[model samples]
Target: MKQFYLSLIAFFTWVIGMAQSGGDSTRLPLTDSIQAKKSTFTIGAVYANDASYYGQRSDERLPYVALAAAYHHRSGFYLTGMGYRLLNDSARLASAYSLGAGFSFPLGKSFTADLSYDYSIYPKFSPFLQAANPHSVNLTIARESVVDLSISGDYAFGKTNDFFITPQISRDIDLFNIGRNDLVSFNPSLDMTAGTQHFYEYYQEEKGIRDSILGILMPPVLGGSPSEQNPTIKTTNRFEILSYNLKLPVSYNRNHLKLEVSGQFSLLSKQAQSQPGKVNSFFSAAFYYQF
Candidate 1:
């Protein structure tokens, strides 16, 4: 498993190198050509059938309300405060998370690099999260181009350590030029994550040791009865490919306000233990005010 993840890391690294030097003209992809404001705030909500990523996934739709405020320094240093709340079934999972800061700098004037650290909390006791655990700290390193690659690691949390290696590529097409300062664009993106099984515990009906402990504390069904059939129990920390996600985000950007509606489909690996009925797909609409 470790070897597979290491290979995944190498593969993305190679892709980044190719992106930076692959073109016949040796020109880089277009990035933010204008100088962006130093400070910005984004407030939005994501309503989806499930939260799917390389390191984690929920077979069920759990909505997230999120807010973010960030400041970028002239020296390439940036800090951000982020928070989110999970809607529905609050008794079993966590809500409102991730405070982080990072730095982004130009790499040879062709690519960009970012490094960040984050501390997050999972407020509920389930196979997926532990409220009693220490504030989880994670570090991420990223290289950006036409395709972006991020490698992150989590420490001091669950019984087994984990890493999230993701590669994301996005393309944008202008549906129409609404005006000089206003237009709508259709953005399609592909994000792939490969990591440990701990992030995908939700798909399996079986409970691990930590889940068993939580179950022991609470009744089998919350004023309900135990099932007659046996449930499957699995171990944790097994590494595997997590998901391949494709997202279509249609955004209408008019000045400082951005409105978007998107649908995401994820083809999770067979190891996810998810059935056809518990598929990973969702649609979401978001409103953001950026300044």
Candidate 2:
């Protein structure tokens, strides 16, 4: 992992150096149609502090750096996935990730809708373990003009049968002169989520945490004497607002390539706020290209 990260740093340094010298980074993979269709192939690296994306705490807190690849077409179809190396918490390169494929289409004058299925796979100790679900179908609709408005739904298929809905709004502003022919912009957005009780069940350690190691991290929450008839009841769980977050993303674009850097400041609602050692902010850096 250390060597891989060092290599990645070198790769980015070289790319940026060439771009600054007015050199081209095109790979010669496509022709005029690729440029006209706005077909893009992208790879990026992300540094995230929020290990507990489900809004829960663990005994250990570790930041993660992930590598991601994605492809998009002007026709509104995309495929994307991430591979992560867990830092401090574990020493695995492919510890956790989600892969998604989807299609998008215009709904009306300014509205567009997307449909996709996300497959989340976590091998090591991660928040997704308790839910017993890995498959989720996501749907999103939004407008991307002067102001952006989007709503999304995610339904997990598993024993937990969890579902969540999120609504968001955003705006973009032009930044100061970055490069003469390059574009710079900053996007700020806010979003809120409401979800089913099953999604939050990871918080209830007594009922969840089937793995012995995970049980140690969370600790059993339920208590009963030797004479107790039932240890834990299924009806004790309830649902509330899942989370809300404010995100700021800035980007620079030149030619058919763009480099983006962003920060996500998040706030959890209801029982989700009680997490300890949980980092509420995540940062990312990405480079994208078309044609």
Candidate 3:
């Protein structure tokens, strides 16, 4: 994981060096679309502090960096591509990567509809087991990957555009064959910046983790017996997490600086078993800058 982050940092450093030498990073991707007026290239880093176990002081910190190139055409077409990489604190932790694409088109004079898809994947690793007191081992479970697809449209009302409403439906895929989460959200936007916006989004995952993981089999080695090469462990345990998120954008400079902050809360309860879920609430903040 450390090497992964180091490599990402090295790549970005190389890009920055190229940018300093009069090479255009925006033109590096969509060479045909570099003629747009409102195009920009941005880079930013974010730090997030997460607390779990019903907020009982199980805190974790994660940091990541992102880069994006965006273009707005004279025909009202918009396109953007972004790459993000997670920095891991532990050598055994997995580093995550994400690719996002989005487009927004005018629905009317005062409204626009935006469709976006973000695909994220994490490297595979075994759970961490630390010896505690020489007699007990503490197991830290692995984080799963989720693919998020979201579609939203907003209608602006009021003369000053101070008040508006937005409705969106989104789906979350486990990607690892665990389970799927789907939900719809009704969000409202308020004007905060000069033509800038603030939004609140709320949604839920349709299925729980227990139902999702039950069909998947444990590793053959863990289930093997002395007489039988493979055996099945008999235990019925399952749980699901209900989640909600609040998203807010603080700064936007189209070229220089953009900041985003999000807070998330989740409720976990055992369905077939009587164990508590490992996670509780998480908060994340991100920033971007372009030169």
TM-score, model 1 to reference:
0.65
lDDT of 2 by residue, 2-28 (tens): 553464356435433333222322221
Better of 2 and 3 by TM-score: 2
Candidate 2 wrongly placed segments (more than 4 Å): 1-36, 52-59, 124-131, 202-239, 273-279
lDDT (10s digit) by residue, model 1, range 1-291:
455447556645554444432321111111121135354444444455455444235434456656655555656666666665566656533365666666666665445566666566554443233222334555555554556444555444444355556667654455666888776776666666665544334323334344566554434554544432223224336655566666777877777677778888766665543431133667777666655
Listed in order, each prediction's TM-score against the native is 0.65, 0.71, 0.36
TM-score of 3: 0.36
Q: C-alpha displacement of 113 in model 1, angstroms?
A: 0.9
Return the candidate ranking by TM-score, descending.
Answer: 2, 1, 3
The alpha-carbon lDDT assigned to residue 76 of candidate 1 equals 60
**Predicted structure 2: lDDT:** 0.60
- lDDT pick, better of 1 and 3: 1
User: What's the CA error at residue 147 for candidate 2, in Å?
Assistant: 1.6
Clashing pairs in 2: none
Q: Which candidate has the highest lDDT of all?
A: 2
RMSD of candidate 3 to the true fold?
A: 20.7
